[model samples]
Target: MKRGVLLVAHGTRVPAGVLAATCFAEGVANRLKAQNPLWENVLCRLAFLEISTPDIYAVATQMYQQEGIRELYILPLLLLSAGHALADLPRIIDDIQRDCPHLRVRMSSPLNDHERLVKIYQQHIHDALQQESGIDALLFVNRGSSYPHSYRIFQQIVQQTSASFPDLKKTSAFFAGLGAGLSRAFHRLEKSGVRECLVLPHLLFPGRLSAQLDRQLKEWAMGHAHLHFRSAPLLGESDELMDVYAKQIVLFSLRRAVQTV
Candidate 1:
């Protein structure tokens, strides 16, 4: 049976965000093709959940009808196990399966709390702060979620990252819902006499939210000249990130093959 790999991400209004997702998917596809002959014939496509074209349902239908792919493996590019991963994605997949009962659809786990991902975060933070000195605190920001599991994963990442860099005080905040929002978190850091801070956004792509955070941090920094604040770039194309994607695809494909056999 012909196999297809569908890489899905939370879409964004920003063009760069969509491009980042597409580039990452392409990198993974290229790596898969290079690593194994079996994947050479595999059809890989990128889709989004919202705010982008070629949504999941439409892509799946096209693959089934036009490409005639018998099996598909969905690799979610989300970093947390939030509403989209837990509820929205499954519902969308269910709808797709109902429409094309003959096509087999399988989903891999979200990119949450993996060791490789933690390593990526650590590398990004280290790279961002390498030029600066006297960084008292590092506030790792994420697009927060209401789900308890998402919170737990975020905490896990914070704890692990803190341990990796014991010298710098590590804290976390959310852009929305649960935990301290960005402003409150920054206030607490200032009240605690954190003179220099590295604000690291734990996001995969550059989107409107990332842009807003950048602007807010800059504006806030201006008011408090005494405090030094630096915002790092979101996680973009990187060799390590591509490795994580390749691993996910290989593992998912192996699992599906075994189950089918």
Candidate 2:
């Protein structure tokens, strides 16, 4: 069977965001190619759900018609199992299945609540701080979702992260939905006598939201020189993350093979 891998990301208006996603997909494809000969023949393509062109359906159709790919696997590059993962993605997949009945397609779960991801965040925080001591609080900023479960998972992650560093005081805020916004969270922290803060954005890639947050933090920092503020980089391209994707693909393929047998 001619196999293809379609990586789906929540598209962003920022050109850099699109480039980052593309780079990540390319890196994963290269890693998969080198790791196993079975993936040598597999084609890898990138697609977006919104604010970007050439969506999943378009890419899958191209692979089927032009590349003669009969089997396709979709991997969502989302960090949480929010509305997009729970509803929008499934609806799109159903449409694709109806459109291409001959193609065998499978979609794995998102990268939410994954142990590796938590480890990655921890590493990022440690690396970003880099011996900076006397931090009053660690503020985690997340792109909030309307789904209650998403908020629950986000809180769980915060709790886990806080547990990892019992010495540092950790708090969380959202970019959109429930709880306080960035400004409000920071204000509360300031009121509580937090003079030094380490802000970590729980985002996959640098996008509009990340850029906005960076701008806000910079402005806030400039205004309040007394309050030391630092922001960590987003979770960009990494070998370990690519390995996760490759493992998911391999596992899904094995399960599919068993079901076929």
Candidate 3:
């Protein structure tokens, strides 16, 4: 069966977000080229859940009718395996499967890849801290979710990353939900005598949220002369991330082939 891949991300309204998602999809495709026997001829495409062009439903239909794809595999680019990953995406996949009953479809999640992401984040922090030192506190900020399990997992990952920096006093805050937000995190850190702080925004790519965070950081810095913040850049199309992602695609293909047999 001819197979194709879909990389689905939570869509962004900003132009930079659109470009990042598109470029990352292309990068994933290039990295997988001839890397696996089963995936050698496979094609990868990108789609978004909402607020972006070329939604998942449209892309899947095009792949089936235009590109003659018989088997499809979906890889969600969402970091947290919350409502969207668990509830919303499955419904979309079900709709696609129903519309094309003959098409074989499988989906995968990146929820278990926290360790890999943390390694990347650590490297980013190390690079950012090269010019400055005495950054004794880390405020890891996440997108946050309403789901309990997802929220717990986010905290767990924060703790896991914190373990690596024994010297830095670490705390986490969420961008949404009931958890402590950005302002609260900053105030907490400031009161705790964290003079030099590293504000790590654990975002995958650039978007409105990233821009908002930048503005907020600037606003906070202007008011607080006592505290200094060095922000680590958001995740991008890194070679290391793409290499593991390509292997993930290959591994999924192998497993699917065996199951069909």
Candidate number with greatest lDDT: 1
Q: Ten residues in a row with the worst lDDT in model 2? A: 252-261
Candidate 1 lDDT tens digits, 41-151: 899999999999889999998999999988988888888778887788889989988998899888887763378777877887788667777788889998898888788
- Count backbone overlaps in model 1: 0
List candidate 2 stretches off by more than 4 Å: 256-261
Task: State the lDDT at 182 in candidate 1.
Answer: 83
Query: Number of clashing residue pairs in every model?
Result: 0, 0, 0
TM-score of each: 0.94, 0.91, 0.93
Off by over 4 Å in 1: 257-261
- Among all windows of ten consecutive residues in candidate 3, which has the lowest summed lDDT? 252-261
Candidate 3: segments with Cα more than 4 A from true spot: 256-261
The CA lDDT of each predicted structure is 0.83, 0.81, 0.81
lDDT per residue for candidate 2 within 1-261, as digits (tens), equals 889988898899898999888888888788888898989878999999998877988998888889988888888888888888778888887887788878888887777336777777787667756767677688989999888888888888787776778777788889897777888887878778788788878887778899899898888888887778787767765668877777777777777632120
Error in Å for residue 100 of model 3: 1.4
